[model samples]
Target chain A: MLVVSLIAFVMFRFVGDPVDQMVGLETTLEERAKLREQLGLNDPLPVQFWNFVSKAAQGDLGISYQFKRPVAVLLSERLPATLELSFVSALFALLAGIPMGVYTALRRESFLSKLFLTVSLIGISLPTFLIGILLIFIFSVNLQWLPSFGRGQVVDLGWWTTGFLTVSGLKALILPSITLGLFQMTLIMRLVRSEMLEVLRTDYIKFARARGLKDRAIHFGHALKNTLIPVITITGLQLGSIIAFAIITETVFQWPGMGLLFLQAVQNVDIPIMSAYLLLIAFLFVAINLIVDLLYVVVDPRIRIGGAEA
Target chain B: MSDALLSVRDLVVEFPTRKGILTAVDSVSFDIGRGEVLGVVGESGAGKSMTGSAIIGLIEPPGHIAGGSIELAGERIDNLPLEAMRKVRGKRIGMVFQDPLTSLNPLYTIAEQLIETIRTHLKLSERDARERAIGLLDEVGIPAASRRIDDYPHQFSGGMRQRVVIALALCAEPELVIADEPTTALDVSVQSQIIDVLKNMCAEHGSSVMLITHDMGVIAEAADRVAVMYAGRLAEIGPVRDVIQDARHPYTKGLMGSIPTLMHDSDRLTQIPGSMPRLTDIPPGCAFSPRCPKAFDRCFSVQPACERHEDREVACLLYDEGGRP
Candidate 1:
């Protein structure tokens, strides 16, 4: 977290000052000095960093220059939007990707399997921004089936708010989620297929067959369970990337999420918001990796024993 | 012949390689009668394991039973559909592979694996299956069978794990058990214990066994009848004592000659000159002709057929009626 914060600090520090972004070019020099002094921008770099760190540790991320609100408040309001999108998209990716991969691996020589492989290749190769635009063109402009952009009206339930249950909201979510999830789906599918192939060739699988186990039991029960160890690791890592790096999809769809907020903050030179976003993303990656490690103990007994020994 | 429990006739298993077809088991024929133990002994790469795999329909892809038939209790099973073959495999014909580590699934408990097989082949309640699993475990000489039944494969020692595997194979009370080098991966001290357990369990259950191994001592101690293989072909087969005392085929003689004996003090053990021929480069006539010390002109020109001698079957020109040279 410190390294990430320092990197973000150094990057934004080298860029032109936020004062120039906040005020007009014709502003008087005295007014500029007054504003710089008020914001503690006149302090030395080390003092400035120390101030930022102390404020961040206390959950006071300062005010966003662009939004004119506390960075913490803006993040809390937008966090649910990003979480909802990520949860739905990740659920879709895993539900569809793993089974498709298993089917393809089993029927590797079939034409349908070949087609799925080709489609997954294209999904991984194409950029998410292009996929978003293409989806909007087909579903919004050409077919008039779904909304083109913007997160639809949300229903606040005190603890959590979601656009997913509403009709217009669900329609609005389809294109952007698909655009965001395409790469993850393809990544998961390819990983599952390769892992399943290797697991199917293992000695235990062969012995399972010799034991006269039903093909379904051997494939899904034995082989798929073994394959899931690696797949879960990849899925957890990808989930972090999906939530942190949905910038392009969020921008194209005008989704009210952290990615869009971060983009607008960068444009308006909102250093506090950008730095907070960087630190949050780094924290998220570390947390997700820790979760993946714990999940290994649940899925595999051998790993559980090893962990117990440690 | 009618009482034979498992009869494998002219079994030919082949692998389609980049360089034409490689016949791994070349027209190998053998039988195990009711409550009989047939030991198949050969050097490495002599297709001993392939023959066992073929009988159970577990030969891996690109390697298949190209020709021949396997009959279990007079019903042909070689050409059965995959589903039907599966029914026959664990229920009628059990298999114990060489490596105990590989044979058992590491994640599941011994009881789970055992009960699954027992319930699948036998119509028993889960409770009944659990009882049967424990019973089989106890029968296989596993100490504290009830408690150890719930333990995972990794928790057991190597010999104990192999015993668990033996219990698993006999869970359904299969009529025929194909044990392919079951003791190969064990310590020398544990090898005889496992073999003794296997022999006693099979005898108690009255199941015919086809024991595939390269260990001559195991065959002499455990098998009633013995089959010797050379380059995928059966060289000689007879009562274990007769074959050990007076091996008819030259390859069998070479095998017997190589066993070090305490009865005779020999500075060096007798060994066959050359190794078994690879499938791709097997000579047109006898596969053992190049290695046989008594190779004659006819042995190089004509492939000898397995013919009955005084008391055993021998596949060599010397055993032929008029062609003896």
Candidate 2:
């Protein structure tokens, strides 16, 4: 985490001056100097980096010059949207991908399996923005069944707000979520298929068959459980990538999420928002890795023993 | 033999390859009476393990039973449908694999594996199944069976794990158990203990056993009868004492000579002249003739049929005549 903040600080510092974005090229030199002083842009690099580190530790990210609002407030508003998208897409990917993987692995030579493999190949190879446009064209423009862009009507619940409560709201989420989730789905499916293939050939699986376990029990209860260690690891890492790649999907769909906010902040050279975004993403990745480690103990008793011993 | 618990007759297992069909087990026949132990001994690729797998209907894909039949308790099982066979497998026939680690699922507790198998084959409630699991574990010589039942495979030592696998194989109280090199993966110090546990527990359950291994010592200690396989063909079958002391087939004689007895101290153990043939390249007539020290024109030209003499059967032209040599 410390390393991530240091890298973010260094990278943001090297980018073009935030002052140029704040005050236009037409501003007088004396006025620019005064504004730079007010923002502490005149300080040395280490002093400026230390100031960012101290303020970030207390969750006091500075105001975004473009919006004239605290970066924290802006993030709280947009973070939930991104979180909802990522959570839904990840859930969809896992629920669909794991079963599909198991089915394909069991029937590797079947026509349906081959077709699924080909479709997933396209899902992985095709660009995210292209998929978003294609889905929008098919579902929105062609069928006129769903909205083309933006989060649907927000329901302002006392504790939380979401656009997923209404019918049209769900319709709006369908295209963007599918567009953003397809790649992860394909990735997880391929990973799980390969992993299941390997696990099915293991001696324990043969033993399970010998024990007269039903085909369903052997495939799902035994083989699938064994395959989950690698699947969980890949799924967790892919979850981080889903959030990262949502930037492209959000832009294509014009969704009100952190990815869109990040894009606009980058365009305006809003250093505070950009740094806050980078730090939050790094923290999310770390948290995900920790969760995956914990899941390992839950999935495999051998790992649980090692964890307890450690 | 008339009251045999399990009967396998003229069994032929074949694997179809790009080149051709390779016969892994050729015209093998045997029977195990109730509570009997039949040890199958052979070199690697000699089809000892293949015969066991064939009997259990566990031959891998592309390798299948091309002929003959298997019967359990007078009912033909060779042509049963997969679902029926699944019921017969753990309920009537149990299998103990070569590697204990491979035989047991690492993710599940011993209690879970045992109880699942018990419940699958028997109409036992969860509590009753768990009780049966613990009882089987105790019968197999596991100390603190109740506590150890909840432990994973990795938590047990190699010998203890083999004991657990034996417990699992017997949990359903099947009529027959096929143990393929059950002690091959364990340390020498624990091998005898595990073998003892397997022998005692199976005998107590009144289950017939087909033990497959390349180790002659294991066969000597555990088998009531012995069947020797060479080049995927049964060379000899008889009581363990008769086969070990008075082997009639040249291949069986050579195998017996190779065993190191303390009384016959020698610098080098007796060795058979040539290795077993590959499945695709087995010789034309008697597959063992190429390596037999007593090979002759008739031996190489004729595939000898199993000839009975006294209480044993030997597949050799040398034993074709009625009188004993």
Candidate 3:
């Protein structure tokens, strides 16, 4: 957490002087000194870092210069939106990707396998932003299937077709989620297929066949379990990238999320708000990676790395 | 007894390589009776392993049975579909592989894998399967079977893992077992322990075994009959005592001579002169002639026919004596 916080501080610090950001280069030296003194830029580096750290620990991330409010308030308000987008996209990716990968790996020479591999290759190779735009064009302008901009209002249940929590909301989320999930899904699928192929090459698979195990039992039962180590590691690394990608995805879709808030802070130069938000996202990514690493050890006990111990 | 419990007749297996079709097992044949062990011995690529794989219907891709008939207990098994083969496989035909280290799935606990094997083959409930697994584990000499069954493959030593594999194979009490180098991947002492377990277990269960290995010592100790493969063909098949005491094929004699024996102490170790040819370069007339010390003009020029004695078969010119053309 400290390292992550330092990253936020250093990222802002290296981007150049906060006083220059605040007072501008055209100001007189006396005026700049007055502004620097007012902004507390005269404080030592260690004191500034400590001040931010202590306040952040207390859940009071100081105040944003541009937004003129506590950084925590903006983050809390937008947290749900970012989470919702990430959840939706991750659901699409896992739901489609794992099975598609398993299928391609199992049926390597078949036409279905070839088709899936080709599609996954294409999905993995292209940029997510390009795919996102293509999807927006197709669904919004060309097809006119749903609203192109803006969002559905959050309301109570019974509005099945057209409320924030209803089919309209679901439809609204679908395009952006799929566009965001495409590359990740493809990447995961490719990872699974390759790992599954490696697992199949092991001697146990040959033994399974000699034992007269059914194809499903042999493929899913014997082969799949062994391949899980690499698959799970890939899943952990990809999940970190997922959180990062969700930020960009939310920005592109103009969703009312932490990502949008971060973008606004970046544009308006809301130092505390942007820095705090970035550190929080980094914290989430680290937490997620830790969770996945532990989950892998739980699933397959054989995996033991540099162990502070699970 | 039962006209042989498992009979492999004129088995021919071939694989299509990039260059051409290379025959792996050519006109090789053998059988195992109830409560019998037939050891198939040869150097690597002699098709001993391929024949074992083919009999179990586990011939991998690009390699397949070209011509053969496999009869298990009077029923033709060559045409059985994959589902039927599966039903036969853990249920009626068990297999123990060479590598004890990798034979069991490392992720799942031994109990889980064993229970799955038991339940899939037998019409047993989960509780029954669990009980049966413990029983099988205990039978294989795994101490504290109940507690240790939950441990993953890594937790067990190599011998213990191999024992676990044996227990898995015996879970269904199949009619026949194809133990392909069952003790190959164990320490020297552990090898003897495992071989002893297999011998005693099969004796009690009335399960025949087709044991494949190149170690003459294992064959001498465990097998009632021995089949020797040279290149892709069976060079000799006979009762163990006869084959070892009076091996008919020059290749078999070379192999027997090659075994470190106190009785036949040569100045240097008696080795077959040449290396076994690659499958693609197998000679037309006789694959072993180039290496055999007793090779004559007839041996090099024409393929020797497989001839049968009372309970032995030999495919060599020496066996025919004056009968060769």
What lDDT score belongs to each candidate, Candidate 1 first? 0.89, 0.89, 0.82
The docking category that best describes candidate 1 is medium
Worst 10 residues of 2 chain A by lDDT: A154-163
Report residue A80 deviation for candidate 3 (angstroms).
Answer: 1.5
Better of 1 and 3 by TM-score: 1
The B-chain TM-score of model 2 reads: 0.97
Residues B1-325 of candidate 2: C-alpha lDDT, one tens digit per residue: 6699988999999999999999999999888999999999999999999998887788999899999989999999989999999998888899899999777889999988888889898999999999989888888989999998999999999999999888878878889999999989999999999889989988999999999988999999999999999988999999999999999899999999999999976989899997988999998878998998888778777888776778888889887764223
Those runs of model 3 whose alpha carbons end farther than 4 Å from true positions after fitting are: A14-35, A155-164, A303-310, B264-266
The best candidate by DockQ is: 2
Angstrom error at residue A41, model 2: 2.1
TM-score result, candidate 1:
0.96
Report model 3's TM-score to 2 decimal places. 0.93
Q: What share of the true interface contacts does each candidate keep?
A: 0.47, 0.74, 0.61
DockQ of each: 0.62, 0.79, 0.64
The DockQ for candidate 3, computed on C-alphas, is: 0.64
lDDT by residue for model 2 (A92-210), tens: 89988988898899999999899989999999999999999999999889999999998888787764568789877777788888888898899889989999999988888888888
Model 3: per-residue Cα lDDT at residue A136: 85
